[model samples]
Target chain A: MKFNVKIEVMLKPGHSDPEGETTARALRELNYPIESVSVSKVYMVVLEAGSKAEAEKMADGMCRRLLANPTKDDYRFEIRETR
Target chain B: MKFNVKIEVMLKPGHSDPEGETTARALRELNYPIESVSVSKVYMVVLEAGSKAEAEKMADGMCRRLLANPTKDDYRFEIRETR
Candidate 1:
């Protein structure tokens, strides 16, 4: 079966997000009246694995090695069985 | 209106992704029986702006300046009015 997994990674509180902050500043310049703006990184990974346990292992490996910087960002994920 | 913007950034074909490649290798070690796996980055942006045109402008700016490296990534986005 194929599983669709979505992972989100975001800077931990007190961590500088110069990119997001710069973006918010630019939006304000455009007269956006921006109430709030938050930016996060997302990953969409599709994997064909034999079993749920194996899939979970793959997901964990993916997150630790590439999908996130554990020291700077917190990550979360959702997995959907797409047959 | 509040706009929910989803941005996807991907390495252009032929671009080397050492991180993702390393991840794939790790998955293999886990006995995933992985037929194939493709990974892409996703961004969920919530922005409260005054107008759609301004929102579009902000989105473009965000993508070019930070969300992606134009030289290495191809990006596409969707904007939905959520409120």
Candidate 2:
């Protein structure tokens, strides 16, 4: 079976997000009532596995190995069966 | 009302995704059964607005103006009321 995985990686609370901060500053200058903006990453991967559980395990391993930074980022994923 | 908006920006189909391609190459080298990987960006914005409609409008405007490159990327957003 094939699975389409969507993973999101974001900085943990209390981490400084310079990119997000700079973006918020720019937006505020553009005259929108914005409090803050934090940026993250999303990865879409298409892979095949024997079962959903196997897909989940592979997805988790991918996040731990390359897709997310363990020290500073919190990551989550959703796996959906695809044609 | 305070709203939490999640905006996702991804390269349009047929556009080269160098970052994603590199990541996939690295992953394959590490021995994971992966076909392809595509990367996208997510922006989490916290702001206050009079209503959901107003929040949506502001978010759409933000994407149009700065968050996304309209010609090469496709974007979508979700807004939820926050405390």
List model 2 lDDT by residue over B1-83, tens digit each: 99999999999999999999998898898788888999999999999899999999999999999988988999999999996
Q: Can you write out model 2's per-residue Cα lDDT over A5-65, one digit (the tens) per residue?
A: 9989999889999999999999999898998999999989988899999999998999898
lDDT (Cα, tens digit) per residue for candidate 1, span B1-83: 78888778888878887766665676667654444444566666777767777778777877787667988998888888885
In model 2, the Cα lDDT at residue B44 comes to: 95
Which stretch of 10 consecutive residues in model 2 chain B shows the poorest summed lDDT? B26-35
Residue pairs with colliding backbones in model 2 are none
After TM-score superposition, what is the CA distance of residue B69 in candidate 1 from its true location, in Å? 3.4
Fnat for model 2 comes to 0.91
RMSD of each: 4.4, 0.9
TM-score for each candidate, following the candidate numbering: 0.58, 0.97
Residue B72 in candidate 1, Cα distance off native in Å: 2.7
Tell how far residue A8 is off in model 2, in angstroms.
Answer: 0.7
**i-RMSD values for every candidate model:** 3.9, 0.8
Residue A64 CA displacement from its true place in model 1, Å: 7.8
